[model samples]
Target: MITKILPGTNIELKSGARDADLSVTGVVAMALPLHWGGRVTVIHAGDNTLYPLGYKISDPALKLVREVMNGAKQLILYRLNTVGAKASAEVSTGVTAEAVFPGTRGNDLSVVVSASGEKWLVKTYFGTQEVDSQIISAAADFSPYYVALSGTGTLAAATVKLTGGTDGAVESDYTGFFAELEKREYNVICSTDSDRAADVVSFVKEQNANRAYVQGVVTGVHPDSEAIYVCNSTGGVTADYELTPAESCATLAGLIAQAGVQTSLTYHRGITGWTDVKPHLTIDQQTGRTQNGEVLFVPLYGSPSVLYDITSLTTFDEDHPKDFGKGLVMRTLQKYQSDLQKLLDTRCVGKIRNSVEGRAQIKAMVFEMTSRGYLAPGYMEDFSADDITVTAGTERDAVSVVVGIKAVDTVDKIYVTVTAL
Candidate 1:
């Protein structure tokens, strides 16, 4: 008899040493009218053709992008100006020079064609800065950013400043945009349109009825809407663009993504977006709004940064007097589903047989998750080896695995009792 070491055994030993890494699930999607970038279509982070957003306030495209990015790992921007009017070009008589894309920002652009010795000089100006300048004998070498050259006009030493450029009408194509967004996965989606935001929540529920739950954070239409809409009743108007309710929620989404899987947003100070939440809501009002499934930034002593994390979940939370309606719980559930799916799909699928050995592997991974604080330690005993059932499903080509998970929740409130002697 000889002792044999199997290749599979070696692989198992190596994999067992490493635990499953927690996945980040905070991708955001929104639609906006962007100037000079995107062809009235959907653009993702990897699209190099899309114009990049800058940190400058004058750049509306970049400003909006930065606003959403303040709370998301990545953003999927859809330029919603397909049927809308394009900004009229400030034509210099015979030239086809026009602002790229349709928007009001084109009004700021001006083009100047001058003669510099032999080569004709074409310069585009946005305010005092000369954005584009090119020396070309023909219109073929025109700058793409500022103007598109046209006509067979002969070269001349003359300058004409563009005029009569109008920002064309632009509208959000919510139906088309949402349909496209359905094909991908994102954690938080923020919208200022109340009707669209409500529809988003419905879509999220429908998609997550079986699995993959995503939360939609929207600006409330009113103070009494039953949704995860936030309010900024701050008395003073500050210049921070992030002070807007929608942007604030986007920031909160980012915070939740970076936070622990089992944490709550209660008392977690909002990021550097808002200076203060004013009009100091009474305790009763705050409680009522939360009961109606609305979130608000509360003023606490010197800071108005406290974000009360409440979900727009109305039906189930009312029946159960727990923190089930809290955004933290939804996030924890997302983490649990995402991590478990990853564990099963990557490690358990096809690698191990559906037998006692496979069941053991599943238990090991679950135990590891518990050890890492992703799952509650005290609930480990509930995750029995026998609890994991890998069996053939109703479909011939399908295998279903059923496993129980206990997610740890954050402590939001504390009550103390004092007895006087």
Candidate 2:
């Protein structure tokens, strides 16, 4: 159970409950928020110059460069797609337009879009963009753009300061949105008898429109969050899902992630199984319920989230990974059994490994505390104590330590070896 998400919404359909549809209408408001680290002063005032670090957009990123041209405000829609992964993907977003009502937290923006054409309203967003509404003012000859705004200030609010950026970067999500829409429409109607991808696509459509099915996609996706993200990928695409969702995108993302993975995930409300899917893992109901039975969900943007490192770190190499953390327990217990006395004796010396997945920079350190307990495999206490600095000779008071050696595949494990003193 990856319960890292903050309190929001948890929706699940019973095994066969309400085979009904919930066709949604226009978009009311969509939000995509990224939390910042606590503010800290970086420097003391020198000649009255106080230096501190603050989050700011760079000239290269998609979000920072897509502000509306009319005024300083960012357009809720645009005619172009700019930035993001180089390899383009076609995505479909159901919501088209939205509305905004002044409430407590600044005037909230609502989007109005069609959900199976019922005209739905969404006051919340997963990762939807405001650019979906930027239509060319004049259709045939490419004139100006018409964005809904009553007052001159509304347009004035659209102006953006010219931070050096390329004009070629039109708007974020534009390409993805259009590509997605075109693909989905084609998939729905294309007469391919064997391609069940259409069935899945149709299922998403029903989820949003009628009371029988729900349709959506994952947006603002990242390793830690499970929220589903949907995109229109059209000119300045529109969306309903975000990395942090107020609703179902979480479930949707989990499913997408699970479908593409070897392990499965279960919850109090529903169960997500990677069944009939490519390279999936199954529930180990026979040999007792174990997280080690499947995949190991690693966390990004933070501390170590791998539970059973000692064995999982070694057993599952790179390609043949034991999926979805189903095998977490077994892998973890194997380690615990090896050092039970040390684990139970709190005062004993213990060590852990540190790795930078893509970089392949592997390191380890000794620890003294258990900061958090998220898996059957224990976590380090005083978490930061992990992968401590090891220096040569007199660099950091080097101490002689005994080391245990073993091969990843060979069963003849464990041998005493000497380390830096």
Candidate 3:
């Protein structure tokens, strides 16, 4: 059975449990963090805590968050350092007001001070909408939700627009983010900054090499690696917002994370709220880009849809065949890898004896997980008990297992022949 563990941790699977029973699918991590609080914030489906935490609807970070929430059930928002300066304004002598959160979103705020009889009325406006207001005799006693007030002096009646708010630098370097992200678990990690495409790909490669088993979605650059998915479309327009290529990358990441083992992204699935794709390409262009290992969005069956669910791996070898380029197969393999790792880390390792009986027990566990967990759920086909092998390892305390699985993929194309009689 699937059980909820600690607050920050994802669901854990009990022994002999089906991977689909407790599989933490669609867990997405956002490279950018909100300005309001904490270096990391975990948002679950239908969670509106961001609004109460001072995140505005118009914030650019929220756009990515909203798009991710459209598909993925959970999102981890991480920030490296206190990147931006807070917007502030001097109302009068010894009286100052600062935004509750840092970043360029604060620049949209303005503070208006009006006389209220013997007291002072301070109002915080986000583009003419009063978000917070307070009336008090002194600045120290004034408490507002949107802006923090400081200093002690006589308040004057004036309107001051907060300035000097900046978004800071794009996270082109992932040195800090990777250090912390290594401790977390997620199905997909997305970079919302297209300029950092190369850096993101490099990070994903290193993480995968270390057996992190996480997928990455990035825009612009093509590394031709199985660990990374590249988006090449531009000028996307959604019903609620105009999207940059980077934003579209985040949306795709969410979709990839949410897709179950039985589903394919290109299975007649369109973006949740997309209205149009920019620089519409012809059928030949779509085929050319798909062959180049780039993901593209085009009009399909009268709606904007992903052209193909493929990765950036064009080069193929015995180990990495052409079918490895299919995103669905890769996701299934990664899920198995992650599940096996979790099983070993949690149940075996130093706890289990390294004897023949112990090895057989381990083999049985793997067999059940492979057949009952994966094959029975239609995630894989052509699996047999003979495909799993368990033996003692070269080390005295280690055991080894070899498993073969054929992942299932959705049918996206059909061919029909008509003979006139």
Best by lDDT: 3
Please provide TM-scores, in order, for all candidate models, with all chains considered together: 0.74, 0.20, 0.81
**Better-scoring candidate (TM-score), 1 or 3:** 3
lDDT, model 2, position 6: 86
Reference-based lDDT, each prediction? 0.56, 0.22, 0.77
lDDT of 2 by residue, 264-342 (tens): 1222112221111111113333112122221222222222121121111223446434431222232222222233323
Q: Summing lDDT over every window of 10 consecutive residues in candidate 3, give the lowest-scoring window.
A: 49-58
RMSD per prediction, one decimal? Answer: 6.2, 24.3, 7.1
Report the C-alpha lDDT of model 1 over 1-421, residue by residue, as the tens digit.
Answer: 2345755333222333565564546577676555544433333433333233211423434645554555555676666654434344423445466555545455566777787788888887766667778888876666576556776666565544544443344554477667777776666656655556656666656656656556566665433222243433322123443345554555455555445354566776644445666556788887876666666677665665544666665556454335456666556656567777777777777776656566566667765664564434332235544555666557654567676654455566789899999
Lowest summed lDDT across 10 adjacent residues in model 2 is found at: 185-194
Runs off by more than 4 Å, candidate 1: 1-24, 33-66, 88-94, 114-121, 154-173, 210-212, 221-237, 240-263, 317-323, 342-387, 394-396, 418-421
lDDT of 2: 0.22
Candidate 3 segments whose C-alpha is farther than 4 A from its true place: 1-23, 32-39, 49-61, 79-81, 89-96, 107-145, 149-164, 169-172, 192-194, 244-246
